[model samples]
Target: MTITHTKAMRKDNTLLAITHLSQLLHYVTGFGGFIVPLILWLASKNDVEGMDEHGKSIINFQLSMLLYILISIPAILLFGLGILSLIFVGILGFVLPIVNAVKAANGEAPSQFLTIRFIG
Candidate 1:
């Protein structure tokens, strides 16, 4: 039983090491760019020790990018000239997740890039 669990643990972490946002975001944009964050969030939620903290931090940061897109779309549509604001927010949304994911790999937690702040 213990051996089986260890094997599973190794598999999960191996997958995560390669499954960071940089690979996912570029691959998953058409599906509303939603799954990337969701998968990372779930992984983070379940990750063990060091990985768990890294996962949670990545999840939180990606969630922020999701929120930024959700909010800025309305802002851009609200008034025709909101294009500039939309462009700015859109760039941040793309950049933050990648940055946070990199930071997480190095065992650091960055500020949320989106809605709320619940993680340390």
Candidate 2:
């Protein structure tokens, strides 16, 4: 006789919402936005419904924003266009998480605009 272990996944909208909202940590502490969701995703992806997809979205969005920020830094020398992009990034960074959190809480998929697919 052989025993097989099966992992059970549960639906936890609150956790998913929190994970989305966790991206705001960057604004408060200047860091941990990516790390927190990454940790939560890694810890619960196998045990939570929708965690994998939401996690990928969050990670991809964060990475995309970082890339934009990096690109903007150099564009700063080009007639201060970088400053505008930076401001846009700032606004998107602050707004998207909240919107995604609400969507997560409502059991809806995230809608992250201008996000590059880095993690899928």
* Candidate 2 per-residue C-alpha lDDT over 23-119 given as tens digits, one digit per residue, 9 for 90 to 100: 9999999999999999999999999999999999999999999999999999999999999999999999999999999999999999969999988
lDDT of 2 at 85: 100
List clash counts for every candidate, in order. 1, 0
TM-scores, all candidates, are 0.54, 0.95
Decoy 2 TM-score against native = 0.95
By TM-score, the best candidate is 2
lDDT of all predictions, in order shown? 0.53, 0.96
> lDDT value for candidate 2?
0.96
Candidate 1 has a TM-score of 0.54
